[model samples]
Target: MTSTVRRAGAFAILSTLSLVVPLFDPVTAVPVAAAVLLAAFAVTDGPLFDLFAYPDDYEDGRLYGLITFVLAATALGLVSVMSSMSTAVFVGTVVLVGYGNLAAAVTREWTDNPASHAAAFCVGATTAGVAGHAISRTLTGDPVTDTFPKIVFLAVAGALLAALLRDILILYDDPVVMLAVGFLCWLLAELVPGLGATEIAVATVVTVAVGYLSYALGAASVAGMLTGILLGLLTIVLGGYSWFAVLMSFFAIGSLSTKFRYDEKVDRGVAQENDGARGSSNVLGNAAVALVAVLGYAASAADLPLLGEANPELFLFAFAGSLATAMSDTLSSEVGGVFDTPRLITTLEPVEPGTDGGVTWQGEVAGLLGASVVAGLTYAVFPDVGLVGAAIVVTAGFVGMTVDSLLGATIEGTAVGNQGVNFLATLSGAITGALLVLAVAVL
Candidate 1:
């Protein structure tokens, strides 16, 4: 087909997809987009923008885009295959995972060897998560639920039109790219281990709501997209689940504690919110452990060993524990940021909110109370957990808070390539809590 015809065809297909993908879930559409992007990249040179519009004029842009497309596809494809993953094994997995990892690598300013490592880690970790979540969810007949792909594409299309009409610089921070990344991340989380449909739904709601609120509040430039995603998820938790209510309460105490010389952290705008999302260590760390636990359950219940049915109770218990830890840590930073007064977590010295080892009086007190509330309320979701499990959930929050602070102070966001302390901290807390209960049973 002629170039004009091909481009026209692509646009037509994309338009059709824009309409249909939403109904089936955007994650499913991601793969096809990725494939098309790859083909476009193959035909281009270096930069991404130039590739779609004028590849001949920008060979460098076309070439770079091609490289990225190939590498992303290759990396995600291999990881998915290696894990023998189920949920994300489909084409959608390749597209979303590729897009997500590519964004992370791109944002990290990865180049040469570091680029490969970033790709490897991002794709491998993501695949592991998908494999783990799928194993358990499928076993229990629960499916991953989300529609971010369509939301992102439509947002991008809208953004592109606005940029074209305004004749402004529609440069790097393209809405389309962000939408793609966000949608991809949503899919990854759906298939993530220690994750569930409930969490996915909560995240989607939070992102949309917060995005709208930020716009209403006039945080248009900074809050319109990504911030909205974060807030949307938060809203879902606060609005839909009692688990978040308690956690938010505890975080409020933690933030307030800093004012009374409890913990000091000089609070700011961006750091106040993103420190948790970008810096959390528990995300990937605990996911690995959850995979094992859920897989074991899946193997047992299905009577097919590796393909066994999942015991819903055990899976729910695991999911709640994981969600509890993540929410607890996130709420801590958010609530803590509400207060101006902050203290050092290590020595009770006053420090910046962005500073590691810093705490706040209001944040700490509120954080704890919040955690206890989440633990208790989350337990109510699954009768299998009983009251004892409730204690474990609350305890995990405390543990997660301590681990997150300690690591942040001592290692997080500061280490050379050890950028996962927060994720690890949360993971540590959840797995520790889960294992503690499991160990108690053994004894």
Candidate 2:
């Protein structure tokens, strides 16, 4: 057998261990699984290592993958024991991870075509969804239709996410992929119960269509497109179409700003890499915080009260603030790079156009405009927020953009990369917006 086939077969067999979880109590199952993994790890460096090792795996990579797979199963088991409704979800996650890996491995060995590999992964995930549902029905004596749509949705989403993660992470991609798929399946199973079939169908269709269009237009790479689709689906389903519109508004603004003076920016060495085509890092840096806000909004709507009282308003403000900050920063960098000479934000010393912490009047103005556009759309979509909430978003955006510049000047190059700064800026924007809303409420 090829090394790929060996790896795939090993994964499938190991994943099947999850099936025995129901026989043991959850508490015992976790420790037993952990012990087994520990034993395997201990022996990995010994003479028996080749039995479980793949030829292409880095030192201990195969063991790491096994550990992650076990962790995923453990998480699912815990969720299953805690909630009666989640048992099937847990089973579905295991099946999807196992089947998806198996299929992807076989496809990789058969052909070098990226599209074919992706198709195989999705097919495996979908098949797992159906088979898992059947197994769950047999075990729990539940009807076949119970949570069927949700299982399928989670499976496909997990597959796409795994594929995206595989592209981005080089060292521990397989492990991360498995862990991510498991978490996604768990999360969606809990949250998606409230959504109707039509709503889910709509979100999926819109997200896929938009993702494809963005890729086709060269605004996003394959990984970026996948990240966008996943984030877009969650946003629309949890926060509503209006929320998704706001996200798209940010994307549109950012894309346009990047293209505004493409040749000039390129000539000046300030252009985004790959002709401004965004990748997974760019998408996640700008939108991960926003996605968190969407999750908060969903939890609020569901009245889970994970964070005190369910305050959808606060999350909404945070969501808008995050996007506003992202747009502001993007426009400031792109437009400011072209229009005016920049000065260091810290000392007012003349600096290169692309210098860290660089500031320009033209850029600041463009940033403000970008913030306002997002804030305005927030008001239009969610009129309940009123002018005060919109104002908070704008203020948060400006504050976050300034913070980005400050960080860029002081510690960006040494302490953190550009993406790290972007994440922090968006996080600060989210916090600022939330605090403002709370202050207004207190008053």
Best by TM-score: 2
- Measured against the true structure, the TM-scores of the candidates, in listed sequence, are 0.47, 0.86
Task: Measure candidate 1: CA RMSD.
Answer: 12.1
In angstroms, the error of model 1 at 415 is 0.9
Report the C-alpha lDDT of model 1 over 163-267, residue by residue, as the tens digit: 221122223222333234334444333333343445654465544454444334333322123322332243232233443333333333333332332223333
Model 2 vs. true fold: TM: 0.86
Please report, as a residue range, the 10-residue window in candidate 2 with the lowest summed lDDT: 44-53
List runs of model 2 lying over 4 Å from the truth.
13-17, 22-52, 56-85, 109-116, 171-173
